[model samples]
Target: MLTNAPSVAPVPTASAPVPTDSAPVSQLAVADALMSLLRDTTTEPRPDIQLEALTLAVSADLPVL
Candidate 1:
């Protein structure tokens, strides 16, 4: 079963620019960002790791490609 879980955005550093928009970002967007981060963090190109991460992300109700 899939469920929507609360996601917390990463804090920006002092040099990072803050957004001017007052509107809240969507959960899907947050999930996508997190997925990208996870992919980038992988040192080697392993299909198994990617597949497992994708499966876990989907099962956790995170938007994944």
Candidate 2:
């Protein structure tokens, strides 16, 4: 069906930064992530350690939807 479809070239992405011997993130960032997880655990109705309810709960909680 296509008569004049142009060939698309793959775009090259920026090179990843080289990691040093030290950790990238600051200690505060790690603390923030831990706090977020704790808050989610306490406030949100977390799903149990089951395969069935897990998928449903995650889908229900999607921000895009």
Candidate 3:
């Protein structure tokens, strides 16, 4: 069946600035975005072990496995 359907397009608002390829992003902004994304993801139940490993690796100036 052929029916007329209205197409929807996202209307950009003035409050939010759209990022462009040429736009320069700050390190803090990138880190914040990454942290925000990771915050919503599932993690191991024993986070303490993972945290301890990361802490020890950083303290020894060694790469995290």
Candidate 4:
């Protein structure tokens, strides 16, 4: 059974792209990438990793979207 888990803080990465105000197109790209990651179960088997990836993805794009 699925249970609600506490949100995890995003892992810091040096390579994470800095969000910019000038790019609306990249917002779609970020959303698409997030969807792709969520759909690919084989690449992200652990739920924690999935959650972290999702959190990072959304938070990164939230400012613009």
Model 1: what TM-score?
0.36
Q: Can you rank all candidates by lDDT, best first?
A: 1, 3, 4, 2
Tens-place lDDT per residue, model 3, 1-65, is 34685532222333323446786455445556556657769967665887898999999999877
In model 1, what are the clashing residue pairs, if there are any? Answer: none
Candidate 1 structure quality by residue, lDDT tens digits, 1-65: 34685547643333232334785555555556666667667477657888899989989999987
lDDT of each: 0.61, 0.49, 0.59, 0.52
RMSD of 4: 22.5
Would you give me the overall lDDT of model 3?
Answer: 0.59
Clashing pairs in 3: none
Candidate 1 Cα misplacement greater than 4 A, ranges: 1-7, 10-21, 44-65
Query: What's the candidate order when arranged by decreasing TM-score?
Result: 1, 3, 2, 4
Better of 2 and 4 by TM-score: 2
Q: What is the TM-score of each candidate against the true structure?
A: 0.36, 0.29, 0.32, 0.26
Native-to-model Cα distance after best TM-score fit, residue 17 in candidate 2, in Å: 14
User: Which residue runs does candidate 2 get wrong by more than 4 Å?
Assistant: 1-23, 42-65
Winner on TM-score between 1 and 4 is: 1
Give the top-scoring candidate (TM-score): 1
TM-score of 3: 0.32
Report residue 21 deviation for candidate 1 (angstroms): 5.6
Residue 6 miss distance in model 2 (angstroms): 54
lDDT, candidate 2, 5-32, per-residue tens: 6643222222222324583544445455
- For model 2, name the residue pairs that clash: none
